[model samples]
Target: MKAGDRIRTVLLAGGSGTRLWPLSRRHCPKQFIRLLDETLFQQAYRRARLHSSPDEIVIVTGSAYEFLVKNQIEELGEEVLHDQVLLEPCGRNTLPAIAWGMRRFADDPDHPVVVYPTDHLIGDGMAPVVLQSVPLAEECLVTFGVVPDRPHTGYGYIKPGDALQNGYRVAAFHEKPDSASAEQHIRDGALWNAGIFLMTPRLFFEECQKYAPEIAEASLPGEYSLLPSISVDYGLLERSGRVAVVPLTVPWSDLGTFAALHDASRQDQFNNVGDAHLFDTSGCTFIHPEGKRVAAVGVSDLVVIDTDDALLVCSSGATERVREVVEELDALHDPTVLEHRLVYRPWGSYLVLEESRFFKIKRITVKPGASLSLQQHHHRSEHWVVVSGCANVWIDGETRLLPQGESTFVRAGAVHRLENRGQIPLEMIEVQIGEYLAEDDIVRFDDRYGR
Candidate 1:
């Protein structure tokens, strides 16, 4: 691809993915979940990099997922340019995110843009299809239309007109259809709208201004509004006339639900899927907690998800309604539905082992050579017990090295820091007692991970 013709890739990564609930919570969403060897967002990044340079790739994610996105991208061992990660204070869905990304690239008139959702699984060679469609993006807004393998009612359908040189013009766009209509659509050569879009930034904004003036006006404030909580398809794609579809015969799965995940994943002879330990089980999807075992017995077509603090058991077919359950829990202000037991930090992770009204127990893991910020708590005192590796602990003005099985105390309002000077991962158990045990009680003096 020519540098002048190169298309900048925008990854929309802000969804909470409530459908994959229990395993995918609000704090640590589905994009960060490891499907194969890497997370879904990482796969999207890698795929984007296959067609565009690192500098040309941009990620738009929620403020809460900013650290998770940064850490995952950084772990790829590439120098990620600053500001490439745009943080949204909250999610306003794809249109606002795409609008923000378009505004960022609108500075360069020559650069085309491709907007893709992060939590999709696509074939390896689909990058060339995106690259090939960039030249024609000026005439028509291009979307990848996956050839329907089955009559999938969960996906939108695209009716194709006469074939162009590289693809076909989209005659009509259909929302998720009923089973009979979906089957008829498959028979009538309707393609699955894969949510893969390619267009020039100028063209995109112009079309938004022309057709979706509300969204265009929303973009003018330079920030997304909380109102109009709708998706891009309902707001733009259904109303736009200048749209084209490129048929791709690739092995792809959205993996948006447990049934889809099970269908996309490999299964053993007993038809059990995932890395979880399955015993005496047939046709089960058991997703285990990381570094833990999830053993099932005499189960079939069951979806068992094991997290540190919560466990979910449901039929695979009922997974699509999991978000409703999560929503009900959220309505009740349930913390388990909001945050996972293991919270990912930029430096490492901390898992909650136990908690009470006045005390909390946590298992903290610091990566090699990583350190926590020099900070003080207002209402809490902590007792740190080194579990596996060496820990360089700083309390008030005193600094000491604590090996495995050693312990230290940090009083409330006293400055403290923890570091892993050793080559191995630092594991420690932290017990806190206080009037308040919330995460916002910390006052940071210095942070290496940019907090």
Candidate 2:
């Protein structure tokens, strides 16, 4: 009962979607990826802000992503508490995630909690719809379904059985189907499951007790790894006869693949999306940073994703098969597909500019008022050069503030750390030289993040 005190919103931020890979990986998933106006997780927070206060929102993410969630929330102009974002020791899918997210709302049984997957992309200003459906949620588990403009084979389908007070009884829930099956499902008056549910702790636990008692009674973060992984659609929604679906006429997309991202975004006359110029190519999507021009002269119906470490060029129809490539690479233990070149840390982030056997170069950025842990490396010595802002460096027993253009050297086995005391981000160039340069070589004395 320590999490969702006076809460109304539960935003699920778990899952590592591989369909948009090269950009999405194990540590950083699609929810945290920068899309249209902002990252999908930020967009979900913006949407959640419509119905609840910052303190009332509960974000559930993996233990490794706690800093990411904190950094993002701080960027949104509000400091987040450690409890606001629940940490999952391991993933147990939606059934356990939702049940655990609803655990701390025991003070108020009928307190309406709207659950949303942070990876979804929905148009803004849809809070009034959830507010209007509160009465229905009090009676039965209310799930939102979007009216599909076309037969979308990627999403699950929901069939409306009979009309309820403000919604309809869920007749049947079908998993993702083939193109032909998807068309038939749409023609039979089925709606695309939006993966958004609104219910209370009372209703949710009651249904879980009857259907999935293991999920209903398990303690999360400790017992989460022991539970079986299953989605809510199969474990609860399809089995519960009291479930209802509310049809929403809004632009909602999971953006599970690059093609879906292109479909949801604004395109050009040639049906191209992102900062890309097409000479003969049409119906393609390119994802890259600005100032980096990506041109396709003689290609068509392809998706080009350019990153610092990896590039993916495949047919637009082959977007769904991106996971296969990731799986193949993962089976080979290819390190290129795990994390991005820009690795996020508790303080800020660091980008590996170049690396070799005996030496490595990095560009580190510490956010304003953030500091690295006091630690020492046994196998490497580091040289820090202040590039943009002020850096408060502590080496051995001496401490000094190095402004821009100043530099310092830290010998191997010396206790040191970097801090940003200025209002702006601290930018520095680090050159590391030694016999071995691996992350595990560091020995921490103290860490604010409890790493």
Candidate 2 lDDT over residue span 1-451, tens digit each? 2122333898999888888889898888889978677899988898888778887788988998988888888778887965898988888789888888888676788888999999999886457778777878888899998988998888899999889876899999988989999999999899999999999899999999999998888876678888889988899888998899988887888999998889999989989887866798788888885699777797778888888888999999899999999999999998766789899998999999999999999999999999999999999999999999999999998999999999999999999989999999999999999999877899999998899
Candidate number achieving the greatest lDDT relative to the actual structure: 2
- Clashing residue pairs in candidate 2 (N, C-alpha, C atoms within 3 angstroms): none
State the lDDT of candidate 1 residue by residue for 338-376, as single tens digits: 788889997799999999999999999999999999999
Count of backbone clashes, every candidate in sequence: 0, 0
Clashing pairs in 1: none
RMSD for all candidates, in order, please: 2.7, 2.7
Query: Residue 230: error of model 1 in Å?
Result: 3.8
